[model samples]
Target chain A: MKSRVWLRWFVVTIGLAAVIHVAVVWLVPVVIMRVFMSRVAAQYGVNRVITQPLPTDLSRTVVKPSPDLLYGVCVFDVSAGPVRLSIMPPTTYWSLSLFDTNTDNFFTFNANDLKVSTADLMLGSAGDSGDAAARFPSARFVVTPHNKGVMLARLLVLDKTNMDEALAAQKSIQCNAIKRGS
Target chain B: MMTWVAKAIGVLVVAAAIAIGSAWAVLLHYPLQTDIANGSWRTSLAVGSTSADPYTRARVALTGLFALNPSEAIYFSANVDNAGRPLRTHCTYVIDGKPFVAQWWSITAYADDNFLIPNPANRFSFNMGNVPTGTDGRYRIVASSAEQTGNWLPTGTGGRGLILTLRLYNASPEILRQLSSIELPSIKLAGSCP
Candidate 1:
């Protein structure tokens, strides 16, 4: 009788341990994957890559972001004005590229046709007022209106390296048109 | 006496089986494989190579109010054929059943490298919103640079790499589950551009 009870107890303990091990090794990864996927979905701001239709409307003035998000983007109305880009300190490999709304072509960035020196950019706009000043080097360029609308403004944060600063800088990138007859 | 012990063991075994099975199903089901059309795209979609790992691929039936996230959908390069000529483009697709209240769906063609083809017509995509459909509600999307109309997705003028993305929105759950049953579009190169 005693041996039988000990054997039953051993089997129960072994089975429970196996269950816990599986939970830790298998279930935990699954849960983490789900959480990661959700975060990616929110971060990329793309609805469904393979299976869904894209929304036509681009009217939202700002990218509404989640707390853990690494990037925020919005496809603005081209008539809105020259896109103002802002970069906060200490974060690396961040950029905002503009595309032809209909054709998705590279337009320009940072007040230049290409990505110019961030240092030279600072030199050009030195002592300008935060408001009404050229935000990027390309600010000097003309905003010629096109018949088709621009599609999206992509703000990429490499490695989510400085996620906190990225989130804040995301808010700082602003856009407005050149004043009428200015 | 033995029967009671056997019944108890059976119950425990069945319970364990259920738990393990459910866990396995959840972990293994989605995203089976992704085939990179290899050199089919002409330009590079990314900064580096054509193939990428940890990529996201989906199987969707573009029927009702479905949408794509433009950010994640990277473009591939458009390549020309081996003979130094533009590729002839011909293609067709089928939608097995009817969709109710389909606002619009589209198949945008991209070069293997993920850039829009340079074309005079400024056409790059085909959509149900503008293309014609059969009376039975079936649809075919054609990709070519040859300037065909009615569901012609403009391929880059050169015939090389091609990637077709079909977008569907607001699809019913029934269609989602039956994705395996849906047929993919077919392509046959008829001739090349001069």
Candidate 2:
């Protein structure tokens, strides 16, 4: 009986020691990772303060996007339909471009080329439009069977001024290719 | 009877001491670092403007001895240290076999302070996608500022630095419970910028 009791005690002691060993190894890393992520969040938050008023026309800035940080840009190609490009505001910087399927070249940034700036579409002949995409009806492109696999690249530009806002805007960007119905 | 009891007590004391000693030893081996220079891995760079976050302050404070959790995904935001301080990048990562989620993963490069490097080719990312694995199915990525044909990510120029991210998604939760056993990539300075 006494021997059995001693054996049980031995097992308990070993188990306790093992628990402590695993905790030290595992808990340290969890703490460290948290520290790293929290630091990033804080850093991004501070960056928003220094850059208050963003440039209305970013074309002239040394850094077009100020602090150009492109997180993820995926090119989605669709066939036999019109692709819809959507944008959500509260972003430090945001833009999208359309690419031709045949040549694989960028067609336009915000519905305009260098020769014609689409920024004026909403204002009519006055060139004082509010939304570039909504103003120009010709901005939307239709792909036929021959032009299958037309592509669009969504650019998620985040600068120091609006890191959190940009990160949040990620969920808002979506794309849908329109098809003909009966 | 009294002698037997005394002997049992003595054994218990020894056992308790051993347990405490073991715990102390394991804790001592924990991934703890004081500063970045004393072997703390450089996860990312910062330039132009420093972070105002307390966590960033702590990271910058501990410039050495940052032990990474190999099984989990780690993220970093970097920037050039100085106006034209060139930052070099290099890493060698390994993946395990089995039905593990992250049997394959990637390491991408961003310019100083976490922006995509402006390359005319639009080839800013470098990862396992470029490196063809052997029959064994293991992968590796080499990040650098220099222009190389295979798995090379440019740092824009020698003047500014770049940020590197190592992502091990869908990792085995079980293996991650034991960080030391899992193998991780080794990031170091390959050379200085021109």
Q: Whose TM-score is greatest here?
A: 1
- Every model's DockQ, to 2 decimals? 0.04, 0.04
Please, what is the TM-score per model?
A: 0.32, 0.31
Candidate 2 structure quality by residue, lDDT tens digits, A61-157: 1121222233322233233323444445432223343322221222323322223322211111112122323433544442222232212222223
lDDT of 2 at B14: 61
* Chain A TM-score of candidate 2 vs. true chain A: 0.36
Q: What lDDT does candidate 2 reach at residue A15?
A: 67
Q: What lDDT tens digits, residue by residue, belong to model 1 across residues B128-171?
A: 44455688676665566556656555654544655554433333
Best by DockQ: 2
Per-residue lDDT of A20 in model 1? 46
- Cα deviation in Å at residue A21, candidate 1? 28
* CAPRI band for model 1: incorrect
Candidate 2 residue spans exceeding 4 A from truth:
A1-182, B1-73, B76-104, B127-130, B188-194
